[model samples]
Target: MMNIRRAKPSDKDFVLDFCMNTFEWGDYVYRVWDRWISDPSGLLLVYDSSNFPSTSKSIPLGIIHIVKCLGDILWLEGLRVNKIHRNKGIATALLKYSLNYGINNGIKESSALVSTNNFPSQKMLEKLGFSKFLEYRYYNINLKKYRDDCNVSIKPDLVFSKKLDIKISQFRDIFSIQEYLSNPEISKFCVSKYFDSWRLYDLNTSLSSLSSFVRNKELLIIVNDIDEIVGIAIVKPSGKISFNGMPMIQISYLNCLNLSIFVRVIHLLLMNYCDVNLFNNAHFLLPVFAELEKILSTKSIENSDRFFLYSKFLDTTSNLSSILPANLQ
Candidate 1:
């Protein structure tokens, strides 16, 4: 028999051990373990089976986490199962439990990021009704190398502000950001557009739980000659260096209406954010946009990773085609 329960502080070591022993490539669960358990808006569940019992406690057979991204946009991540527990319907049960939890709590849709090479996981998500919506390419760079190669300089005229009228407190920021992104002229500057399901959030719930985990977070907004906000860059902490075996700052979002502005903002991010040495190392993570990639290609940085964003609307009657861009579908 298998039993599932909400993970408590005492179960931290068991959960971390299970993740470390199960995954052979790399592990992100340990990096976010503390945050997941501490986040009030998220749920971390552990699965225990009599089949994997230990002398001290029931060794967890599997684990899953549900993170509330905005309103109805719940991010499912850190799904893992012990080797002895594979092919035994453990993963399916955990997924169903998570989905049901979301539905009972008023979640309308769920989203997840999966590696392109992980076919089994992708198959599982698809079997569970998820659709592959977008693919994001990320580039990882060491600050030491970046400084050595980047000789060109641009003025830091762009202003960084978190006081924009749009607040991400409870999904309100989505509307503000979406309005700017919906502009065809501005959308052209982006490599990929935001998914429709992500834009929709429950109006009744409080999204303030999101602000706790992010550190040194800020919104860098760029203005045009007329002093109007033309572009925005979202910045957040990349967790500890040991989490991914490196220190890096993750630029969650970057948008600009023109190449000149984009170049200026990119330079500013490197000089201001990536210059610090955290955990004895300096590095940064920047998603490779087509325009930025072209400009940085001359600097000899290699593309680090490519992943796909998968989403599933719990509502069977959802008109996803209407919400999603024609090209994305």
Candidate 2:
């Protein structure tokens, strides 16, 4: 028979190896294993054989983690199973365990992101009553590829032209962004309601405990001519490190006034960043906000990957309409 239990420190190596080899997207488990095992607001569970004792300890066949976020949200992540143990109901059992954990812990809801192409995972989430309420697109900008194009000198006419002095500044404090998100106009456009400044604070404060490979990051904000905050982007570093020891920077959480402004800010940011050689490349996670959908729909870029968010509410009265935007007329 199989046994499900909280993962221990000793199980870290096995779990890391299992994740690194079994996953094709990237290996993130090892980066957060230490923190997950010790987190007060998180759980790391493993499925293994305990009834049939072997000469050595039974390795974990599957593993899953759940983190408590702001707004009493339980975010499920890093679900992985050994290839040899596929179709053994391990994933389902793990999900049920997560539900029970949430209920007992007083978390009202849980959510996760699944790749659009990964139908099996989507089906599994749907079977468990989760609803796919939102979609996000992830785009990777190869600084090396854009380096040549961005290296050109500014045009003399443009240099003398009068324009809004839009500038990008790194957010040193989290509360500034928190206050910005509280605006009804901006909050309504956000993809994750629970993702506030407090969440960003928690991320910076708690992520250090997870591993040294991942760096604490900050947000880049765009200020307009009159110094009004217009757009913002998150600069996060992933768990995986390159062969040369540089970690990839995820340039996500992007929200701007318009496509033209976004393109200009991104180009300016990239130009300045490439001069310093911060990372090998950067990724942009695009949420389907108001006009962004139409802007991208008109473009022919095909290199980005898409992911969908599915949320399951433990409270019976809760509805997807509460969190989702109304259909456009």
Candidate 3:
């Protein structure tokens, strides 16, 4: 027999053993295990298998985690199944359980990120009714290499030649920032959501949400000589350590007036926000733009990987049978 239950502290070793090689670089499950287990707004589940006598203990076969974000978004992540138990419906069961939990808790939508190369996972998500909403690529920067190759003292010629008078400063004006984000053009660029700390939140431009960013001092804005907002960058410490034990940072969202401005903003961020002795690397989750790609290539920065954001709406008024299979229903 098999069943799913809340993950316990005792399941750490067993779960981590299988999660070690989830990808070429390994997995992040271990890094987030504690946070996921302790998160009150999230659920960490383990699939237990029992085939022995009644007195024997059930063994963990798989794991899944779901986090409730602002705007009633359910962020699903960390789905892993033991190699020996592959193709036995373990992943499907875990996903269904998490989805049901979200529905019961008033979650309106569900989202997950998958690698562009993971066809199996993509097929599974399609089978489960998720649609590919957006594509993003990770542009990784090596702080030490970047600092050595590029002179940060001088501004890029592109921005300097344009003679665009701009300054990079911390953004705190919640009202104005909210108003700026509400523009249809900006909204289209943001794609109605923002990535932070590896989780996605609806870009509703609500005062409360923007205030949280302000409190953390993670919001940066580019303003012209007249102090009009021209660009924005949402960056924060990832609370994760690299393999070499250095700290990691994430560029959650970035938008600028043009390619030159965008490049300038990135250089400014490297000079001001990223301290080579402090941060080891930064990961940028950016929308797929051809011009941006060309500029990044010129800077010797290559995309590490591409990912697809999948989303599905869960109707609260409908029965589970309408969306889930009979067994799950």
Candidate 4:
């Protein structure tokens, strides 16, 4: 058995090398880890010379990056064991350590995410005591779907709309990024706990650096009649096509409202996220199973049992699934 340590600054180069070689989507892996590591609450699990039993140097064999949610749940965002070190039980050891850490440290549960095609990793997770959980959607939705002829029902009194008029050149600066927590019923569903101001600003800076990136995006603000930011639709260029006729919304933003209104937000997000014309993520629909076909003309994403799962098990985590919604988009 090899000893493990939390990743340190010294491991940055080695870790980066491992990530580049092992991950099929190095950008995706780096982006997710970068997003989480902004706070010390983020975690990294690494294996040294021991786990491999053969490595002479404590080469970076595997890594697991986690994000904290309400203290109870930890998202195992990035988990990889080097290809050279595969089949040596290193993956299992690192995961077991992390999961035990979560449970022991009062984390109620842990979740691991694998792309739909990564069946091998999924099988490994199952062996480590993780069962398949809810599905999720991820995307930057295509904004070309708004139709002038269509009468989509948004509360006129509470709904607020603004046309993104900034020049495409200013997509990053005056990107018109608006954010508010909604009763996921009224607004679209695309948000996370860490989508705070800092993260948004960071996204602005980072996305700006990736210039020449085609951007058919807008940040739609859902304001109450009083003009307070109540909800937000984080529209972006999904590049993902939905059979429904629009590019998909890669992600959404919502503030869960009262149970009744929450239902509406749920419907809104599902419909928006599911529209295949844009691309859809149906597994994100929890607490409801309104037939995809009944709700939309064509549900683009599959409602699958295999989902990217996370758990919440912190002390202050009571009712995070239901709490005073914050201002996020």
Indicate which candidate wins on TM-score. 3
The 0-to-1 C-alpha lDDT of every candidate, in the order given, reads 0.58, 0.60, 0.72, 0.45
Give the range where candidate 4 is weakest over 10 consecutive residues by summed lDDT: 194-203
Report the C-alpha lDDT of model 1 over 1-329, residue by residue, as the tens digit.
44667777777777777677544455667877787787787778877665454535676778888877755577888888877668988888778777766665567889887877889999999999999976666555555555555544422243233322121222334344445555788545454333221122222212242233122344445554554566766554544334255655555556776656566566555655445655222233333453445545335353355678788888644332222212111
Q: Is candidate 1 or candidate 2 better by lDDT?
A: 2
lDDT of 3 by residue, 122-223 (tens): 999889889998988777676665665555444457434343333433345766677677666775555666687667776656776667676777777776
lDDT of 3: 0.72
Candidate 1: segments with Cα more than 4 A from true spot: 21-25, 51-57, 151-182, 189-217, 223-230, 238-247, 259-265, 274-303, 316-329
Stretches > 4 Å off in candidate 2: 21-26, 51-57, 152-219, 237-244, 289-304, 315-329
TM-score against native, each model: 0.68, 0.71, 0.84, 0.49
lDDT of 2: 0.60
Please give the TM-score that candidate 2 achieves against the real structure. 0.71
Ranking by TM-score: 3, 2, 1, 4
Tell me the lDDT of candidate 4: 0.45
